[model samples]
Target: MSAHPEAARASSSTPQGKPRKAAFAAWIGSVLEYYDFFIYGSAAALIFPKVFFSPDDPATATLISLATFGVAYAARPVGALFLGHFGDRLGRRKIMVWTLVLMGVSTFLIGCLPTYAQVGTLAPVLLVLMRVLQGLSAAGEQASANAMTLEHAPENRRGYYTSFTLNGTQAGQILATLAFIPVAALPDEQLYSWGWRIPFLLSVVAAVAGYLIRRNLDETPVFQQASADQDVARMPLVELVRNHWADVLRVVAAALIATASTIFSVWALTYATSDAVGLSKSGMLWASGCANAVALLAIPLWARLSDRIGRKPVFLTGALGCAVMIYVYLWAISTGSYPLVFATGLLFFGVVYSAANGIWPSFYGEMFPARVRLSGMAVGTQIGFAFAGFAVTFAARIAGPDGDNWKGVATFTAVFCVICAIAVATGRETHKVPTAELGLRPAKEPAKPQISESVSS
Candidate 1:
């Protein structure tokens, strides 16, 4: 008989292996990494301008704080090329473990750093370095985890299974936001002096949990099978570029859907709570925590829907929904309508954006063959996410001096949203793409069977 493709695959991807267990571990691991990541975004938006830098020039201080947040993103594309190769070469588990370690160390050290007043120029300089390290580690974390989970998943259920990754991300965002509830409530003296550090220091627990969970996960079946068969590409980056360039471009463009994540989680949080806006700090954070809380459920629902109807329709619906709602969400923030803020945030981040965010794990992975899945996804996503990381600084610059023209921010975000919609709209529908037919493999029948007749005949 011919080789059993499924039988040759080692690790947790086989029918008999613990696919669910592996996915669960990936979920928890990713959740922890994102918790560390979102905290920097949260701090940059709300606290860094006040505490990390010299506040003597308010405008320069804000710009510098925002620049620190962008530092990590600057390192991400570079990190992606290296770590993506590692994941595609060494397997996903190793990359996941390394990411958790890098993020944890940086966050803990950040908690211990001296502010600008105490350390002068060294404070911001060190902060930028830590953020760069974090960006590098993060560039690989989600892409590798998504590929691992997708490879282990049952062919028919890839979308449903991989949705857990983003669900974990929402859980992380929720935890990070919850961590700040107490910190944001502290007095100004405490907030600037030490309360901010409290959230950063809690990285210890998250790192420990991520380490323990990720260490136990088996390498993905696809990667294991490649190694056993000695079919692993000599250079995954070159292989991906040579054969999968179009798909890489498609994935990059489609990944613009992530704009929804940054716009809601980072931009909206800052705009609503800034002293210029009059909304309380805790109020905005709760809005974020609550919206993602709802997203925890909505993300899975959208993925399940994609598993049924198709990835494109659901994704397009989400893109359009968030585009229109950004207008309303921004308006609510400008007016200080707490009810409007919560309602619109929940509707946009929790429901609309979740549709796109949750579905993309499967959607993007499906575009590449296993030989270059990590390389393709990592490169595509990080390059696309560059816009998101930069959007915070750009949005602030775009904000009118009066800071009331959030309509300008909405317009900027909407143009990007429309671009994302058009890009994804052009891609092939993956909900019906058979497991074996996805990526570089054209559609074909299952390998033919061989049988022998017994003497009884």
Candidate 2:
């Protein structure tokens, strides 16, 4: 066991000035990348079943359309392995740039794709291809952004600094919902034909803005020091598996928390709009947007609290609270009570879910040293997130043909949250640990190097 370069940098302390800048840059990049990713979820729920799928057997069409959204998740683990390796070895700055470009191009192409009416079987095939690219881009974006922030952050403030990446995620969801509201409000013909494409097209602007923001920032000092010391891992995945497999497994289980998100955003939206519930698509979109808007504020607050109290307690509070609150929220939607729907949505998604969502970036990244941090978090979280990506399909099946099984969806969501909480509980409390000491094996005194007699000769 040798000393890691990040440990030496931590002993001296990284410069404090750029952590804020790095956090802001990470925040902006996430907003852009996730905006590209989430807008597809909005469309898959609201527009794609009608526009891209067969009209016969409406229930099956909707399931297939939603399944296309999950196709991206299938690609994520592969992208994580490929991109995370480069992120750990080559540098975070380059990976961030490439992922953003890939997301932007994929999203923009999705907008340009012809529908089932226009292109027959070719339409959905093209749709799935673009979605795979979006998934690939997303696989690396958050992990790399988080690793950059964690490396730059002052030791005591890691939670607060890393929270910005997730705040940006909330912001992106808000933007995606807002973009969909007017389009979702359109007549069925216009919405399916053209209005829905507008949000995907808007991704270009986010791409340009995010690229400019990330391009000028310097690489994190931890990475710079690792490079200077010639200590960069040749194969980060190999090293990570050998030394940090338990942390990766913990991160995978904890990352299943994303299941709650997709269910709320995708499945719940579809369920509310079904004839059984009769909630307006625009209304549900507004509820989601408002929840995410509130989350943008709540994420940083929860993260600051994690910094003070440690990660697991705040995270468990969130995980368990969401378990209870999602039931109330979905039940409210089932009852057709708009006020109750909005209120519960805000509480569950905005407040409770933010507790876990905001903290995981810091908590997971801190489980590895700089040499393997990006690869470890990326591979672990992406594989877990793949489960979340398909949660909508599972919820659709559990709800049956009429889509009225709010209780089943709620039970599914709550169970996922419980598992996530248990996973978080099993990990070490890292808030009080020095940044340099995190993920370190127990220390042993190094034997003094023996002088060779040949050197004296």
Candidate 3:
């Protein structure tokens, strides 16, 4: 296979890179995109059961609502394949703008949906359809944004620049949680009726803002050069599979680390505020908000550290640390100790998980040549994330009757974290490799002839 000429040019053209502007664009776009995506999670856990599903069986309704949250994940891989192909074929900037628009439109429509009481079975069906659209939009958002930032980043600081995408994500999560605090506090009648729609309706503003920002952004020079050189893969997915399948599988496994996020943000929220724990919904939201606020500071720092050291160590630290901390965080919630919950939540998610979250964009994007980078990252990560998306429903089922099975949920999450660590362990250390040489097989050294002293004489 031919080497990526754009990578060679990118390695030398540091001054031409738009690291700051591109990073900011990626950051703001993710903030809006994930804000739209996460609001559904908050509603699913807190409001959707009563509004969208049959109220006759509260337990069944809760499980079904959570399942609706996962419905987006099912659609993500499909979107990844379609959007990723065009992203590689057309350009990343176009896909970024499209995803923002789709997410905003779907989210706004979700706010306008009629409740189960109003429309009977059609309510959940509409909810699921909207969630699927959100999932599809999300499928391309991170991968395209990550590719844009990374290709525009200076070779030595790719981790730090790409980190902005996730920083935006953490910020979005904070916004989503905070948005729900006031709404969640409304009286049940008002909450079920109209208060819940406010957050979803607010997505239009974010979407419009994100669209404007993304549209003004220039395409990454790396991608532009590839296009000029006619180096863009005609079938990026086919090329990706032929040359980078193992890396794809590795990314799929490494991406499972996201299971921890869903469990913490969604399932744990439900568990903490359940009748069993008796924790206030506002308190849990505040705790989540605080942790994500801390993560905003921590993500770039961890990404910068990965730039200095390597993606593996920082990533492994996060994966392993999260494996242990899941137990501690969940245990804190189960004990009904608000202090411990806050402390451990900050430690587990804000500080520790940010290491993995901040670095994966750079780490995974580096695994493929520029030709296939977007497709590989999108397809592989989305497939793995599909499982992560459903993790809430699985956590609900594993928690058993009364939903006090915090340990079971913790164990399930921990196992995936460990798997993430192990998968990353087997992958190449791409940090030290030059941008031009990434995804190219290293040249084999010529064999030296063994000569004895007698033979030499």
| lDDT of model number 3 | 0.93
Q: Which ten residues in a row have the lowest lDDT in candidate 1?
A: 1-10
Candidate 1 TM-score, true structure as reference: 0.92
Models sorted by lDDT, best on top = 3, 2, 1
lDDT, model 1, position 389: 79
For model 2, the local distance difference test gives: 0.90
**Per-residue CA lDDT of candidate 3, range 1-457, in tens?**
2244544555565346688999999999999999999999999999999999888999999999999999999899999999999999999999999999999999999999999999999999999999999999999999999999998888799999999999999999999999999999999999999999999999999888998888989898878877877878999999999989999999999999999999999999999999989999999999999999999999999999999999999999999999999999999998999999999999999999999999999999999888899999999999999999999999999999899999999999999999999999999898877766678775556799987768554
lDDT of predicted model 1: 0.83
Q: Show where candidate 2 strays beyond 4 Å.
A: 1-10, 13-17, 445-457
Candidate 1 ranges beyond 4 A from true positions:
1-17, 443-457
Give the candidate number with the greatest lDDT. 3
Evaluate all candidate structures by whole-model CA lDDT and list the values in order: 0.83, 0.90, 0.93
State each model's C-alpha RMSD to the native.
5.9, 4.8, 2.9
Better of 1 and 2 by TM-score: 2
lDDT of 3 at 247: 96
**What lDDT does candidate 1 reach at residue 412?**
83
Query: What TM-score, computed on C-alpha atoms, does each candidate reach?
Result: 0.92, 0.95, 0.95
lDDT tens digits, residue span 1-457, model 1? 1133433232233333356987797788878888888898888888888777887887778777877887787788899999989888888889989988899888888899888888898988989988998899889988988888888888778898889988998898898999888888998998988889988898988888888888878888677777777877779999998988888888777777676678777777777876667898899899999999999999889998998898989888888888898998999898898999999999989999988898889989988877788889999989888877787778878885545568888888887778788888888887766454467544356788777666664
